[model samples]
Target: MHKIKRDDLVKVIAGKDRNKQGKVLNIDAKNNKVTVEGVNMITKHVKPSAGNQQGGIVQKEAAFDISNVMLVVNGTATRVGFEVKDGKKVRVAKATGKVID
Candidate 1:
């Protein structure tokens, strides 16, 4: 199972947004990238179209490498570790040694 999922609170560990926390908006498993809310935002210009009534510059969230962000655990952002428990893989919160759901 993927440690990061939609709606998970994540902290940016690398790049310009480092140390900032946001909710996970989406995850792209095929590319191993994730888009966090309010992080790595990019602006795009679009022409007026039927689907879009107001066609103009729009700010959108961009996907960043999954490795660049870390999950926040127990009020702190920490790296994730995993181990086998009861014949199943379980995620461990590195900072607190607690099992993460």
Candidate 2:
């Protein structure tokens, strides 16, 4: 299982958005990139479309390398590790030794 999942709160550890925290929006496992809410935003110019009547400049989240983000646990950024408990494999916070999932 991946340490980061959709809807997980994470902090950007590197890049222009470093130190910004946001929820995971999407993950592209094949490209090793993840999209975080309100992070790495890009502006796109689009003509009017059927779905969008006034499609002009739209701001949207952009994907960045997954390695640039760290999982946030208990309001602190921490590395994730896997452990088995009750025959179930779960994620643990390396800094706190607490189960993350």
TM-score of 1: 0.89
Instruction: Give the candidate number with the greatest TM-score.
Output: 2
The residue pairs in collision within model 1 are none
Candidate 1 lDDT over 5-98, as tens digits, reads 8888999989999989999999999999999999998999999999998899999999989999999986799878899999989989988989
Query: Per-residue alpha-carbon lDDT of model 2 for 25-61, expressed as tens digits?
Result: 9999989999999999999998998999998999999
Q: Where does model 1 exceed 4 Å of error?
A: none
TM-score of every prediction relative to native: 0.89, 0.97
Off by over 4 Å in 2: none
lDDT of each: 0.92, 0.97
